[model samples]
Target: MRVLGVDPGLTRCGVGVIESGRAREIACLGVGVVRTPSTDELADRLMAVAEGVEGWMDAHRPEVVAVERVFSQQNVRTVMGTAQVSGIVALAAARRDLPVAFHTPSAVKAAISGSGRADKRQVTTMITKILGLESPPKPADAADALALAVCHLWRAPMSDRIAEAEAKAAQLARNHRARLADAARERGSTGGQQR
Candidate 1:
């Protein structure tokens, strides 16, 4: 599976593309940061971000997009910008009909490292080892994006299975309800004939 991981920030959104093999090996296809100047107007910045993300999607053609779920921070403005950037990333994926998955920071850390509370350095180090990179991806944001992709790669199989099971259960329930309705209709018709 090919995944594009997005660590969305207004000033520097990170984008990473990775391919997961059947043997559970992860290969980093690409990694980069999309920078928008703080001096730019909010609308321009957003547009730049949208274009940057869309360009990545077009270039990599990833099957899935994994985005970092925005968490509330003390800085409301920062959180809001992050949320907006994340939305743009998701929208870009949605435009291509790609599946999008949101992974929490803690979840990414836990999946890449052993602990949910692992620090940035630890996560980066582990990511480097996992991908057999000579060095950690420059900028913590880029590494985070890679981690988000890896997390989704690891989790998607089980997640897909669970979704399939739920769908099957729902279908069975619907069929059962249809049968019950049919039986009720037959009983009602017979009762009406006796009137």
Candidate 2:
């Protein structure tokens, strides 16, 4: 699938595109900060980010967009801003009818480096190695976006398996509950109540 990965930020949203499959082809496409002048209003900054993401969608026309899921942390302000930026990115993808998927930071790290706690350097190194690139993608955010794409690709199959397993488990639990209910009904009909 041709996927566009976005690391959203009001000041600098990182975007990357890659074609993932047996061949594992990657195209950095472009990566740069979308800056809104410091004097600009917050709404303007958000608009700039939205425009940047929309421009990317127009250029890439990707099959799907993968975005990093925002997590609440100690810095509420930063987390809130990131969440807003992420919404803008998601909205851009939805506007184009592109499927959007979110991957958590730990999932991205583990998919790229075999460990959820992997450091930034390790993530960049693994992304470069997996993509067989001569140099790491510039700026940590860009590398992170690429990593998020890779993570989604790696996780998709597993997600299907997990869903199937959960469905089976749920079915089994329902059957067991039905059996218990039937037994209770039988006991009640026989007037054999137990304390």
Candidate 3:
């Protein structure tokens, strides 16, 4: 399955594409960052981000999109920008009817480096080894995006199973409730006929 990971930022939103294969083989299709001029108007900047994300979607045609969840930060402005870009990425995926999964930064780090507190360099190093790249992807954002992609690829199977199990459990509960309701109604009707 092909997956696209997005690390959204107003200045430099990161994008990465990866394909998962047999026996968990992973391939990096692409990794890059979308740069928008800070000096530009917010609307224009958002449009730029939207266009950039849309272009990646069209080019990669990923089956699902993995996005970094925006967490609370000391800088409110930074968080706002990240959230805005994140919305744009989600919108793009929604337009394509592709599933969008938001993963926490720590989850991505742990998935790639086996540590939730792994630094950017550590995550990048792990990504390099995982994809067998000669050199690390430039800019932390790019590596982060790749990490998100890898995290999704690794987690998706288990997530699907969990979802299926939950659905089945819900269906069983509904069926059980329906049967109980039918039994109660039958008892009530027989009691009324006896009156």
Candidate 4:
């Protein structure tokens, strides 16, 4: 599966594409950051981000998109910008009918590293090692996007299985209800004929 991970921010939103093979091997197809000028109008800045995200989506044609969940920061403005960028990311993917997943920072850290409390350095180091890159991806945002992609790839199989199981259970319930209804109809028909 190919996944596009987005680490959204107003100034520098990071985007990464990663493909995972059935054998669990992973490859980094691309990684980059989209920068919007702080001086630009809010609407223009958001448009730039939307265009950037759309370009990645077109280039990668990812099977799924993963975005970092926005967390409350001390700076309300910063959080608001991040949330706005995140919404743009999701909207871009939604336009193409691609599935989107949101992962918390801690969840991403735990998926890449061993601990949820891992620092940025540790997360970057683990991502570099996992991708077999000689150096870590620059600008923590890029690394974070890569981590989100990897995390989704790693968890997607289990998620798929769970979804399949739920679907199957729903089908069985539907079938059972149909059988019961059919039986009731048959019995009613036979009783009316006798009457």
Q: Find the candidate with the highest lDDT and give its number.
A: 3
Tell me the lDDT of model 1 at 185.
100
Per-residue lDDT for 146-183 in model 2, tens only? 88877877787699899999999999999999999999
Inter-residue clash pairs, candidate 3: none
Across 1-195, the per-residue lDDT of candidate 1 in tens digits comes to 899999999999999999987586889999999999999999999999999989999999999999999989649999999999998888888889998999999889988898999999999999899988988898999999999999999888878899999999999999999999999999999989999
**Candidates by lDDT, descending order:** 3, 1, 4, 2
TM-score of each: 0.85, 0.80, 0.87, 0.84
lDDT of each: 0.93, 0.83, 0.94, 0.92
How many pairs of residues collide in each model?
0, 0, 0, 0
Cα lDDT tens digits, model 3, 1-195, are 999999999999999999988896899999999999999999999999999989999998999999999987749999999998999899889989999999999999989888999998999999999988889998989999999999999888889899999999999999999999999999999999999
Model 3, position 23, has a per-residue lDDT of 92
For model 4, what is the error of residue 98's alpha carbon versus the real structure, in angstroms, after optimal superposition? 1.2
Question: Which whole-number lDDT from 0 to 100 does residue 87 have in model 4?
Answer: 92
Q: Of models 1 and 2, which has the larger lDDT?
A: 1
**Candidate 2 worst ten-residue window by lDDT:** 26-35
Can you write out model 4's per-residue Cα lDDT over 1-195, one digit (the tens) per residue?
899999999999999999886576788899999999999999999999999989999998999999999989649999999999999899889989999999999899999997999999998999899887777998999999999999998777778899999999999999999999999999999989999
Best by TM-score: 3
Model 3 CA deviation exceeding 4 Å by range: 170-195
